[model samples]
Target chain A: MMEVSPTLPAWVAIVTSILVLLGAALTLIGTIGLVRLNNFYSRVHPPTLGTTLGIGCVLLASMLYFSVVKQRLVVHEVLIAIFVTITTPVTLMLLVSAALRRDWAIGDPSVPVPPGLPEEAERPEPLPESDQPTS
Target chain B: MSVLTRRVLPYPLLSAFLLIMWLLLNQSLSAGHLILGSIIGVAGGLAISSLQIPSGQVRNLHLLVQFAFIVLYDIIRSNIAVTRIVLTPGRVAKSGFLYVKLDIRNEYALAILACVVTSTPGTVWVNFDSAKGELLLHVLDLVDEDEWTDLIKNRYERLLKEIFE
Candidate 1:
């Protein structure tokens, strides 16, 4: 197993350890929320926690560890942070919109009925038995 | 002067950002790196210019910085709140959709607001109707509808309006 160098300062090691543990804990909590949330909309909220702060904490730890041990200013981890921060929202918006569309299509009354569609037409009745098994 | 600058660098801010990003990615501050990064930045700016994307002028840099700090603070606070919500096993969270009527009309500002809202945990930007200037957001632990509305309007929209409008 790899070990921290004895020459390295204790505080750096301590901070890194704390950051890693906090990040892992937050990620665990996020996954637990994903599993425990009752509905799909609620479930969507938890994963953002892991993606935002969870990865943020872990990346900060890595950055600190590498910069301290290498004795240099290492900040390339910020690239990942920036990329993740920007991309996560785009993907999440796409997913939420898709889910909303699916809900609308299925005529789930819980979701607001989209404009121009009557309440009865929200969920179109199933086709006759003759057209059922075309595949 | 304006015409020359527009012809050479259509998107000055984007060019600057690209240059900074290049230098950061290269992890160097040498003369050669600066020249190369500038070249890439110029090329990127010109390429984007060819797309003819509509650009909104940012009127206030101070407000932009202030808004960024507010977003960072909110993200941290929400992270804690969400962590607590997730850890408490039996506590039920009230998640619901909210419609916010927006007065800010700038597209760039609206896009940034959406990104900020969606990126923060406990809130998801679900949809927007451009015609009505209305945004649909989902909140994980909604307590008061008025509070959320005020939060979005006063906290973000006001600042965004100052910067972009």
Candidate 2:
């Protein structure tokens, strides 16, 4: 495997190493939290650290290393950062909404059903007789 | 600008952003790249203009910058806080759901606030009720309910109101 040359400036190497280490360590903590946290709701909070700052630090390191090596700005890493920043919330929102829907369906007391609707009424109505017969 | 061009390029800011993004992605500032990026940006902007999105005006640019720095600082601080929470074994942080009543009525601003809150490590925006202007947030380390409410209102929502309302 190719390695970063030892001849590079000390600051560049130090910054890159620090960023990479911090990012990796944060990501590890996030994954561990996923397992250690007692419930799904609480578990949702930790992985976001990995997604937000974990990837952010790694991207920063890559940008700095490549820019120093090539002697030109390497900011395309920003595109990924921007994309992740926008999309992660979207996916998280969808996942949380789906989880909420499931919990509501199962009549989980902790999960609040939307106001003015009973738990059973919130569930999808059964298919028509013809559709049900086919299934 | 002509009426036709104004209609086509309804989102001039978006077009400019796309053009800059294209140049950055290509990593080139040559004339050829500039021309191509401009064309693509204008086309993309025109395409999106068909969607008829309601434009939200940003009232204060200085406040927006301050808001960005505040978010950055909060993100770093929360990253450390959450990392500690995760590392310390068998220590259960007092996590709970809290409902916050928001004064900001602009949808675009509310969406941005949600993204910022959810992206921060310790808080997740679980659900928002538009009817009541209330947001449900799941906080990992819920020490004081009033503290969370005050933080959200004063730190973020106030800045967002200045920016988007």
- What lDDT does the true structure give each of the candidates? 0.86, 0.85
Over B1-165, each residue of candidate 1 has an lDDT whose tens digit, in order, gives 488888888899999988888887988889999999899888999999889999779899988999999999999899999988988869989889999999988889988998899989999998777778888899999989999899999999989988998
TM-score of chain A of 1: 0.84
- List each candidate's DockQ score: 0.62, 0.58
* Per-residue accuracy of model 2 over A27-131 as CA lDDT, tens digit each: 999999998888777888899988888999999999999998998999999989989999988888778777776666554557665444543575655444443
Interface RMSD after interface superposition, each candidate: 1.6, 1.5
- Candidate 2 local Cα displacement, residue B34, angstroms: 1.3
lDDT of 1 by residue, A3-105 (tens): 8878788898999999999889888888999988888889888988888889999999999999888888888888889899889999999998887666666
lDDT of 2: 0.85
- Where is the poorest 10-residue window by lDDT in model 1 chain B? B126-135
The number of clashing residue pairs in model 1 is 0
The top-ranked prediction according to lDDT is: 1
